[model samples]
Target: MELSQAEIEDLLSRAAKGQIVRTDFLDPAAASFTRDLLRNYPEVNYKVDGGYPSAERVRFAFFPIYVFPEDVELNIGFIEITGNFKFQTVTHRDFLGAIVGTGIKRDKVGDLILIPNGCQVVVDRDLVPYLIQQLDKVHRVSVKVKEIVREELLLPEAKTREIVAFVKSLRLDSVGASGFGISRSQMVKEIEGQKVRVNWKLQVKPSYEVAPGDVISLRGRGRVEVVEIAGVSKSGRNKVILRRYL
Candidate 1:
């Protein structure tokens, strides 16, 4: 994660001012960068949330260390889109395009939660009105939109496939490919193409070693986490347990 020096300095300066600064929703890479940068300022307190549990992308808030408010709230809202639709037909990309088409910056938007009847979009509270007024359609389908309380939001249960594999070593590409059912040659190609990420940072080296608790994400293939390296197999191979998100 290559961040500009100016950006880090600006964030530090804002933290020093004792002001509550909220950043737009950041990708995993950017979020990691911000977390690393905040380490330099011990007096700055921060929190990261994405309006729901286990969200991949999230927003970060920086506050003064002395101000520890009990009920610090997030500036977020949910937009529920209702229409005649079928399950799995409307995707996150469709809803995102409609919102971005309304001139709302991508950073202002948070997670897009797809439900049985409709989809819920999390966004900056300030953009709720505009989104409600301007987001009229998604992919040419007329839709009705309404704001829902945070408590009313519904998240789908994550589906995962657990597998135990025997590998010669714990190299990232080798384990990831085995877990996700991709060929080693293809995994190397993907890594070289910059489509592989380890713990949110892009990893271009296929030979990069992985350990237990490491989260690996392959573009277009979903994510997986190393649950455990149980032990060595009788054939001198490593036994690894992986949970692949579906």
Candidate 2:
């Protein structure tokens, strides 16, 4: 859902009043918007965590401008859904559809890790019970759900393909198009359509310079990280190393 400036101000106002306001699961675009909004209100502190390592989408919690206790944990829960792995393998989209079908907002859900035998989903704590009760099927396959401890959560292993390419410039579009094997015009089109993200924030400008260590995500194309700038090529082009998530 699109949030207006007034709604953002109201959320900040509540946080300033010492109220702990937690938001639903926010996609990269919404999360970036919230981050930009929070920049104007330093008095209202907040945190964004997706409950696992390397989570792209996340939930935001607004806290008063005060030192937090050491024991304060993020309000995240894991739901382990197991099904007949031999008969049907549940994919990330399948689990996501089942969760969303239960009337849960997209922002309330986090990463969905597909395991060999089942899948694990990170979600807001408030919706744990509801998800467990409602997430009984994934597509046409029957599934079982139960809450698991944070330690029990299984994270997906990263599988990336290293790409070494030379581009005219280190701009997002230049490196992304060359690394992903797309035309420059196609990359620009994707950027203009708001289907490209740099470091998890929506970046519309194709000319935005991308630095080493920056991760670029294109909708429908997976993600790619600029690993390093090896050096300048003989022709004065940039020699860059990229790791594309597979």
Candidate 3:
């Protein structure tokens, strides 16, 4: 991820002045970048907050060494969208499209978890009222949007498909194409076009090596996790086990 000069500098300036600094929702790349960059300033302390475990989007709260990390407020909110499913069912794209249509920037929103009979939406707390009033329908389906506590969140089980494949090298393109079930040529195009991400950071290099536990995701497609790398096969190809999120 390309680090923005103003973004990091502004946060650092606040911390240097002993002022509590909080950022808006940040993508995984920005979060990772800030998490690493702040380490240079040992006087400042920070907390990575995404409202839930394994959240991709998160905010960082920076304060002085004297301040309690838990005292910093992330101001995250959880909202649920439920609708009559017999007539029409909604998808992630549909939910996102409807939310984006409400004139809210994508950065203000976070992850949308799919659940039975509805979906759980994590977002900036200040935007809750606006969203609840403005967002009422997705495509042709009528939805009910309401605020919910963290414990009330009905988390759904993640779906995955395992792939066991062999390749000469564990290059991004080779593993990505195999996991995404696409051709190497097509994967290259997507990578160069900035449609691919490794661990939620933009990765344009197809030759980038991927180790076990690295996540490879393609825009419009689900994510893939490199689960294992056993010894090379008899044919000399590298053996791999990948779990592709469905």
**Cα lDDT tens digits for candidate 1, 1-246:** 223546655866786797777777887778777887888888888888888877767877778888775545568777898777764377889888888899988888888888876689889988888888888888777888898988888888889999999999899878988988988889999999999999888999999999998889999999999999999988999999999999
Reference-based TM-score, model 3: 0.76
The parts of candidate 3 lying over 4 Å away from their true place are 1-5, 93-105, 129-143, 164-166, 182-194, 228-239
| Model 2 TM-score, 2 decimals | 0.82
- Decide which is better by TM-score, 2 or 3: 2
- Model 2 has an lDDT value of 0.83
Residue 12 lDDT in model 1?
A: 65
lDDT for every model? 0.83, 0.83, 0.86
Report the C-alpha displacement of residue 179, candidate 1, in angstroms.
1.5
For model 3, what is the C-alpha lDDT against the true structure? 0.86
Number of backbone-clashing residue pairs for each candidate, in the order shown: 0, 3, 0
lDDT of 3 at 71: 84
Runs with alpha carbons beyond 4 Å of true place in candidate 1: 1-9, 69-71, 86-89
- Candidate 2: Cα lDDT at 185: 92
For candidate 3, the C-alpha RMSD (Å) to the true structure equals 3.7
lDDT of 3 by residue, 1-246 (tens): 333747776887788789998777787778767866787888898877777887778877788889998788888898998888776767888988899899988877788888877789888899899999999888878889999978886666678999998988999999999999999999999999999998778999999999998999899997999999987999999999999999
TM-scores, each model vs. reference: 0.87, 0.82, 0.76
Q: Per-residue error at 197 for model 2, in Å?
A: 3.5
